[model samples]
Target: MHKLLLVMVLAAFALPARAADPLPRATPESVGLSPERLARIGAMVETEVREGRIPGAVVAIARRGKLAYFEAHGFQDGGRSKPMPRDAIFPIASMTKVLTGATLMSVLEEGRLSLWDPVSRFFPAFAEMRVVADGNPDSTVPAARPIRVIDLARHTSGIVYGNRGTTPAHQLWQRSLGGYSRMSGGDFIAAMAKLPLLHQPGTTWEYGLSIDVLGLVIEERTDKSLGEAMAERILRPLGMQDTGFVVPEGQRGRYATPLPKDPVSGQPQDVRVGLVTPGFEGGGGQAVSTAADYIRFAQMLLNGGTLDGKRVLSRKSVEEMTRDHLSPEIANNVTLTEPQLTNFGFGITVAVRREGGSDVLGSPGMFSWNGAYGTSMWVDPKEELAVVFMASTPGLIRQHYRRVVNALVYGAIAD
Candidate 1:
């Protein structure tokens, strides 16, 4: 009986391991990513979870308005109490710029505001704006050119975040708590007017708080708060139900906790960065959303302005918005200098796609951006793909989440 059992076990082992579990199918050969490829993506994400780099993540892929792949991994909190859900909400940081940009596009569509409108025309304090000189706090500068709505969108309006390096504008920004800390967009604009421009408008590319200024421009033109205007123009139409600055009382717990690195110990620390507060309403950083919410926003772009019968923009406007509107120098600076991580194309970061360039996947014109906490999404129109990865930790960016996503998504495409 023992000999017979051993022979049976050997025969089972020789049966070729059951083909390693068939890969999941996602789409037809002519469509987007294949199921086998998406399965590989699932495997890669699972490996990351097992390795403990990301505590939890929600990844989804949409091709031609269809959710080809949607999977969640890990936990919502570090304690592994709640599984990460597909609709988990995250702060989505600067990714809000795309929505802000879309709102600006809508304003342009309505003829209420023009991209070339001088910011000083609406806000007089910017009329006599000056740049920092010789590190002098009160140095006066001859106005080179008036800053415009386009300048803010392109990040050439000469503003700084006040923490990266020091300049006169940085100092003024530091001194102007009403702008930086006040949660109101109107108050922030008032504070911005108190400070001086860092450079002549439209001449240089500086990644500062210029978009927040654009939010003020939108509010002033519409007579509505930024949130209200966005809801009416973009959010509600796109069905981005969970994307906004303020989380309602019952939904407060749905917001993901930001895992900021501790300054003293250099370890991951749970810092509950609330979605709604008195301070972050107007800046480009206020919008909080889920991966699904942002994917819908991206799909609108991918579909050339309308998704699910909601016409957020026209194809012409989407084309213009995604096109490089900056001077060659500014584009180069965006790619090579400032952020030094990616290129910028009017409100969103455009990934450079030269064969040997900074980008490792797809062709030119791939555009995307990430939030402060590790939520990232990119749309590759050339490849007809949109990949999103959302995590509640700040350190996930440096962990190659994007690299893995790109690799798996492309790898899964069946020939």
Candidate 2:
């Protein structure tokens, strides 16, 4: 059958990208964490796998600039025949935003862009934007201010994603934007410009196509693909060898896959991304990376944008990126609906906890973010900690593990 041959052809190109060298290992206590308390994570993740919540997961933590806990739980596939590799590649969806944001900072350092630079500066299509008016699908109001580079970083751009909710505005986005993986950089921008925004630009802390637009900005400003700009600005500089827009030809064997059907939602969940190349690299959530490589990226942020003397960003830029960019009047959407995010605020492509109001256990100033496909990483400057969680599960459990991992890791803090 044609379908069968297509599968075979795709598999032929799917084949092995190994992770970069693992971070230096140390006993949990050496990094001021309790070995016994950290073992609780193993028990918790095992239960998650046994319950069929996830095909597999990888948890890696670095504190005091040393790797303390590196673990892989469950099997690589639904069949459970093969063990999950600690360095298994995963579709680190939204986690790619931080990389894109950081790359844009490199462009910023070179004066190609500025935080206040309007999106229309790079792509004029972003200028004549409209917002849904009177809560009506057919209504429109011009954005009070142009969506800026900073707005995109902090997700206040008001450009909404099509996947969530069935509101008229959401439907408009869904109907207008299709086949994104097939769109060129310019095509993607043109499609987005055609859709009305969910909120007035800079008025709402919305999580949506803002970063994806930033991706196009990166590609345009650097005159290279988003993937190439990211490699030059963050991946290569940080020595994140295994992270990229496409999983190399022979590296498909290392790609972790999701369950055939969601155990909870029962929808077919096929999150094995990064097989073929997209027409334009998506910053919203398209990169595949391993636990080892992703943690390195997180560690770089924790180290104030440098790792082992490789300066991916200046210290002050990292500070600004991690700080809370939202004011109290800014209405938070989608992510803020969660009780755990009550004490949090949006930052450049990540979330920053203002204080300790959430149910989750973490330091007061921890900055973190997760992917739709069950990947999460956080940097706690106060704790000198960076933790990366990679998995193939999606849906409700993605945020669930955000709480679970933070509790498990912070609970193990011995000092």
Candidate 3:
């Protein structure tokens, strides 16, 4: 009898305690946010929808590890009949860089690669890359240094986007666009190697295809496709079931869509939906996610790289990823052409507060990034907060929603 009692007691102690919920919902006041102020967020979004600016939106805010606010406004499709669902999936374009960054950090944790490793180490063709100066293809000069993995992570590799401008680099990228979406990772790297970099590596900060190159590096190091690697390293661990390169058939109804024609220009916007499995997974901007799913990703970082006891990255790695990695000149040399009032971090945009008037509202240490298709996310370590805004518009109008959301979120702080 004593042996049976002892066995039962040990078994009881051995049973794992119930795990804390990954994200617990709470009232706004319970999380130090005023419900009245948070209502303004929904109002602003509804106003935009009413004015025919955006088709729909999903906004969510979490403070001190509690979901204080969440709302779905407007319609999921271009038509106003179908109400937008809170679980609506968005084409989280460049926001994929954040996931790409986290995946690379996971690789770093496993000792598969180092930040200072040169791009040529994984793909030898990058060793022969050249730089184009004075917007002349014929005026190419050898890069001063090989593009390092850190250079790619921080956007200093001088790999500008294809549609940037009429520069020689941009023209080359535009010419190479044919193979961008269809080519394999290896082929894409080879094509990228043939084009000239916009500037010398590790010198200037120009947002471009750097993350895409890093994605290929991750594949080479892990012997897995980007989607496969991300699933194993991030999505599965974090339980972000709704985020991936392609949405399943059943989830197609929740995919958000913007107006076919621009409300202002009446020009047909190029809004591409990723319903089918992609042949090539571009790490730069080819992923879709819902607001709830992305908030879990952001919350993991805000919780010091662990969500519900699943450690995706070390706390030290999260700090390194979020800290400002730009040089003084690059951070201060703001021009009309470059990103204003912000600094670049590893795969994310770090918001910096200037002394005078600023373009957005947030804490100085807050780090965030957005997608071309009207998705925005930010993590404020100071406030222990994470906010996600999702829509489908793919133009400059998304900027207005960003500003309004930022104001409403910060303005709702009650304590």
Number of the top-ranking candidate, with TM-score as the measure? 2
Tens-digit lDDT track for model 1 on 1-415? 9999998865543323122111122343435456766777667656755766566788877765566666777776655567777677777767777788888888889888788889987888778777666656588576677888788887888766665456655766776752474546556666766666666677676666877888778888888877888999888987778877777778866666533453234686764444437464554767778877777788888888988776899898887677766665553355432242443444423323332344445557777666666777778788777777887766534336666676677777665
- What would the TM-scores of all predictions be? 0.84, 0.92, 0.91
CA RMSD of all predictions: 9.3, 10.6, 6.1
Best by lDDT: 2
Segments in model 1 whose C-alpha atoms lie over 4 Å from true places: 1-30, 134-138, 166-172, 177-179, 258-274, 329-331, 335-356, 396-399
Name every residue pair that clashes in candidate 2: 15-250, 15-252, 15-253, 16-250, 16-251, 17-251, 93-285
Worst 10 residues of 2 by lDDT: 12-21
Consecutive 10-residue window with the lowest summed lDDT within model 1 = 15-24
Per-residue lDDT tens digits for candidate 3, residues 153-206, read: 888887888886777668878889644777777778878888888888888877
Cα lDDT tens digits for candidate 2, 1-415 = 9999998775553322224345666667766899899899988889988988878788898888888888898987766667998878888999998888888888888988899999899989888998889777688988888989988988888887776667888887887765677788788889888788888888898778788889888888889988988988888877788899899989788888887888789888776568888888999888989988888888888988888877889998888888888988888763543445667888888888887577777777788888888888888898899999988887776778888888899999999
Q: How much does candidate 2 score in TM-score?
A: 0.92
Residue 409's lDDT in candidate 3: 92
Query: C-alpha displacement of 63 in model 2, angstroms?
Result: 0.9
